[model samples]
Target: MISGLLLLVLVGSAMAQRDLSVDCGSDGWVTVHWRPGLGFSQTLDQSKALLGTCPPSSLMSEDTLLFRVLVRDCGFIQQVMEGRVTYSNMLIYARRPELPIITQLVKCDYDSPVGEESEFSAEEPDENREQETFNMEIMNPDFSGPAPSLRFGLGSSIPIRATVEPRSHRSLRIYMKSCEFATDADIRRATQVHPIIANAGCLMESKSGNSSFLPRRHSDEMRLYLEAFRFALGQKIFLHCDLEACVVRSLNVDRKACHYVPEKRRWTLLDEPSQSYACACCDSTCPRTGLMIDGVSVHKVLGPLVIVENEPESSGSPDSRASSAHGMSASRVWLLVFVVALALVTVMGVLVISYYLCFWRGGRLGYRPSRDLLTKY
Candidate 1:
């Protein structure tokens, strides 16, 4: 009886050492250390961990816990190795009845964030009271994730939220506006909102949550009067943005340009503004010369070209008359050919049917009996 009691105490001591320890490293490495009996036990819970500060509450009937180690790096995590361990059931213990132990190593990768900063400036006219004033500020812009740094595509809208410091008694109104770029004979226009002024205060909160404003035509002349302030080209435009606002801010942008010919009355690239330039030549006039640049035309001399409609052609050259006649002749020729073909097909079909009936009598080329009956009568 005393020997049996000693055996029970030994078993109890073995059960008490059924714990595991694991060490994780930043270099995607994990090391595990455990006692042979409990670690190799096949009856352990595979999903439970028996190591570190929070160990599994209970072990398997065979004194083991199911534990797995995984590594994550470069946005990926994978299990390198796994297996079950067992004592005498799995391993032949020479003298010590300990289980066969196992350990695994793994490596993985995850993505890291990259940062950048930029600055921009612009000016405009005030919209509130119609004042020609401007404001400026320094902005440190940062972009993250999968966004491009320069030359954004069209249809891309960036959310903007900012706080302004006023320099005058008038409330600093923050807004956006449009600008115009014209050549000697062309007028290329674009619209964008610059900051405007309104009330003067330190913590001026501008809620840009639903403020989805985009550039429009004639926006160059009209500034986005944020109440009392305005921003235009050759004007001051900058701001100090709050951290919360910066995270959500984004920009929607598009660009287009086209070519212009003075002699041609056609205005091309009107639908595709990105590729076409703005022409200065009025629809009423042709042969008027002008300077074209960047899809915009600028007129050197202002004359009837600027006004007056329904101007008659002052010259009728032989090329112009011939071109008109050719267009008419082509239409006439096509119509005549279509009518003639239809008539010929109808006549040919009628003639073929008549000839077949007259030449080919009844079967076997023999005479019919209608005439014989008439002769007998």
Candidate 2:
């Protein structure tokens, strides 16, 4: 509906089969405009409930069931090989709960654009660079800066904010596809990696203790809470997240960052309310983006965050500390005396060795008599 790059969708009669209208919008969301009347009304396939899912916004369209889903949220299978990435997913209309009646398959290539120029480049494309209007930061609860040390106070939350400067009236809907913490700035060569967000914005619940996307305040910004971590000898830490923007009027909460909160015991939407239905795919394998959204998809970085182990705490009572200091000074004096004595011994030994060598060569000429021996008596 919102103007998009009319994707490979050819809406057939009764939704026989068609490519979804894919729009890589400036806001980052890969809006897939699906055709109507997929015949969910006609099918009594109870098993269909278990097969796949659609975004809450797309499915409940009065009865047509013309579905929409963050392709990565609805059982989309992704494959990468030979400098290409492919996403595959299907829709099922079963006869009974199990018997199949009709099935439709959809596939999207990240590199599959209308033009023949489907090349991959390390640098971002010019148009995508122009659309990027966002910033990633490490901040506190009140959104105050001077970021805290990574060692203390558990961990910190990162705010990735987007502001349309000329201030577009369009509601800015942001979705994070995935995020990873890497040791290297160049993601392609990162040695150590910890994926805190994956499966299209699903937090690594069990892996990262309290890492989750916090509820959003304004549509302009989103926050993520990373759990406390300890990695010593860390050179540089970088948090990289792939962000998408939807240039639409209403809130597109269906496909934003989601996490399962243990305290509340519920799945929460990162940008919207917690009563989530579209987030069901977050736990398992979410759908994959069928359309190439690189134009609007922006990967943000907040780093070299510098998460390191805490310093060793100092211990010792005041009186005992004074004693320790006194003892340390005494040890330093002893060490200095020992060093001086050893140096004199070394010099004396060297001179004696030289005299002995001379005496062996030229008898008494090499050695002068002691002072007592030199006495006239």
Candidate 3:
């Protein structure tokens, strides 16, 4: 019995070691490590470490606990290798599928002590008593040129590419917000979100040919790719993007520039303000451009094109032609069966009729002693 128990324990340990899947629903930020020779380089869960999702117990607030890592170079590499590096990373936290409509009484019940009086009123304040203002600012930096119009084929799985040049900044990061409606207000609402579209890292000038800017510049020249699947198919999606140019500091320090505020239940930009060249980079003096970088130029319409297969000229519509072809194939099978049945019936009938006329009737026109000269018996 003890030996059996030991074997079971060993089996359980083996299975546990193989189960490397991440539980994002865990209570805290789960830190995962990946090495080159750990039998596997990286798992899907490890690769998605950048996706910062809050635990169930964590309040859905504007403030999120950010995780950062610092890596030190031990020695110079002796071999050269090629790989594609992703400059832009985004954690898409879509609003919960179903938001519970909690009444003020429910909130008060949760926050207040069991028998204590509340300082704040349980009733909601009148809307006419106070006016709230959301600063609709276009503080985001401008592109060097006009935003390009893009057309994508439906189900193609290709991304839209754009290019922008940042001035007086360490890096330029682009965040996209899309809405079905094309109204300016709807567009304004999209910019307040945290999903990033592209990030052009710090473009600092350096004399060395091996500077990171060279690779970034080359990549920007190549294209700023956006996930095309973000837009719904067969509709004109209004894309409003905000460019946060890291002018005073690098992106590594200003990682909180774009995030959702759980307390307010709204998206906000923290840590840094959007860049504006005309205002000397002052947030107070600068007028927010309603998240429009190039005025109307920043807005774009993406139409998902439908791809149709080429069909040969036929006597009917494409659908009809297909149906006719199918019908013809089915009829041909039936006709071939009918012909085979007729041939089989004909062969059987011939055999039966020949047997009756020759063998049963003795092959004689009149049954008179015929063939007497040829037969010996």
- Winner by lDDT between candidate 2 and candidate 1: 2
lDDT of each: 0.25, 0.51, 0.26
Q: Could you give candidate 2's per-residue lDDT for residues 198-235 as a string of tens digits?
A: 76767774334755666677665676666656542446
TM-score to native of every candidate shown: 0.18, 0.47, 0.24
- Clash totals for all candidate models: 64, 11, 13
Tell me the spans in candidate 2 whose CA falls farther than 4 Å from its real position: 1-132, 146-167, 205-207, 231-234, 249-254, 272-275, 292-295, 311-377
Better model by lDDT: candidate 2 vs candidate 3: 2
Summarize candidate 3's per-residue lDDT along 51-153 as a digit string, tens digits: 2221123322222323222111111001111221101111222212122110000000011122222222223344564222111111111223322223333
- The full ranking of all candidates by TM-score, starting with the best, is 2, 3, 1
For model 1, the stretches where C-alpha displacement exceeds 4 angstroms are 1-321, 361-377
Please give the lDDT score at residue 267 for candidate 3: 27
- Candidate 2 has an lDDT of 0.51
**Candidate 2 displacement at residue 159 in angstroms:** 6.4
Better of 1 and 2 by TM-score: 2
- lDDT string for model 1 (92-136, tens) is 011111221221111222222111111110112235633323322
Worst 10 residues of 3 by lDDT: 100-109
Q: Pick the candidate with the highest TM-score.
A: 2
Question: Judged by lDDT against the true structure, how good is candidate 1?
Answer: 0.25
